[model samples]
Target: MFDAQYSENVSHPLRVVPLSQLARAGGLGLGAERSYMAPVLFWIAHGQGRLSVGGALRGYTGHNAIFLPANLSHGIEISPRCQGTAVFFAEKSMLPFPPTELHLRMQGVQVQSEMNQLIEELRLESLSDSPDRDLMLFHRAALMLLWLNRQSGKPHVPSVQVSDMLRAIAQPKR
Candidate 1:
């Protein structure tokens, strides 16, 4: 159920979906097995659950963020009161974060606010029907990755890329 094929028909590769929305739409629920070609980030706003990644099962509580790398076997089962957001992007989308299971280290309130802001921006761009929404979402997600790295205290320094588009996304605006 986490296959990237589920979203292949869409215009862009980046997708930000609210967890509750997915639940209400019957897209996801308990006891579902899913593995994605793309990486996924789970921003748990509230509630607790157990998630298994690559045969390693871990439990998480409220206000936590988790990352599952591409093709990693991962899924979660939470109580009925869970609420959060999920971000899906291309397989190589999450640069700087590495291909590991990460429980993000949110150092302070300000860092948490920054993550929330990034998620909100992602939600907005995902909902917009503008022609440039794809490009916008890509850059926004890149920023989210960068911010996540910063929160982990091991930010990556991006190098030049194939095109200005990629370079722009890798480098924060000055």
Candidate 2:
């Protein structure tokens, strides 16, 4: 069942998925887990839920941000009232950056506030029919991810020759 109110957009190299405005059902249970070819940054707001990633289970409440590395199997058990935004970035987006070991770590500073603001802005931009909204939201998403990566002490893995090779092998032609 598709809701007319919820709109989804795929902006070239990235996918911006807003999970709000969907009708709330009963508690969501675990099912077949899947992984992504590109890194996925998810922000959960206004929900009490549990997520299982790479065999580890973590609980989240209120507002929380999580990063799932590419090709890592993960599943979410969303509460009936769950609402959030999920942003997917192609490997190209991480290019010219350092590796996750040196760039993707999270800082102790609470960045949820800023992240929430970005999510709201993205939601608005996604819903709007303006031509520039997609471009604006795309840049905002990149900035948010960079901020989070910088704070976490993770090195920005640049997509150099070697990095590109790795990405290529990680994503073979379909």
Candidate 3:
């Protein structure tokens, strides 16, 4: 059986994995309607696919990000050309991530670039051995969630400069 409080208190807390890896093991049973204990976000870097969430089927193309809340049954059918990253967030994570499902089709080149950069940073953080790796991961994940919120028409907030964010995360957590 799975850990009872795993979603609430995962050791590592967050993960960033390539979509291919997610699709490798029978798509992690994603093809069949299922729910995760924690929330998951998928950033589609390329290609097209259809996602079924809460019994609603929707088609998505490249430059898209999909966020699904925990315990919300869903399934995905990604095309062979689809490319993306799957971001999993711990249930008890304090980040201000979207509380509902979001399917954002990023339109502008700048927006797409920002999303790409954010995902890359998350990927690097996930692979790093920094003493504050988990902390850094949470920080980057928060920025990404912010980006998604912005694209989804949430209230506008001052954007954090990359240099400032990097410097902040570099500081050792006390």
lDDT of 3 by residue, 76-146 (tens): 87665679888888767777778689999898999999999999999898899989998888889888888
- Candidate 1's residue-wise lDDT over 41-83, tens digit each? 8898878888776666778887788877776766676556888
Model number with the top TM-score: 3
Q: Which structure is stronger by lDDT: 1 or 3?
A: 3
Q: What is the C-alpha RMSD of each candidate to the true structure, in Å?
A: 4.7, 9.7, 6.2
The candidate that wins on lDDT is 3
Q: Give the TM-score of candidate 1.
A: 0.76
> How do the residues 47-130 of candidate 2 rate in per-residue lDDT, one tens digit apiece?
767777767776766666777766567666766577776766654453322233121222234666677777777667666778
Worst 10 residues of 2 by lDDT: 1-10
| TM-score between model 3 and native | 0.80
lDDT of 1 at 60: 84
Lowest summed lDDT across 10 adjacent residues in model 1 is found at 90-99
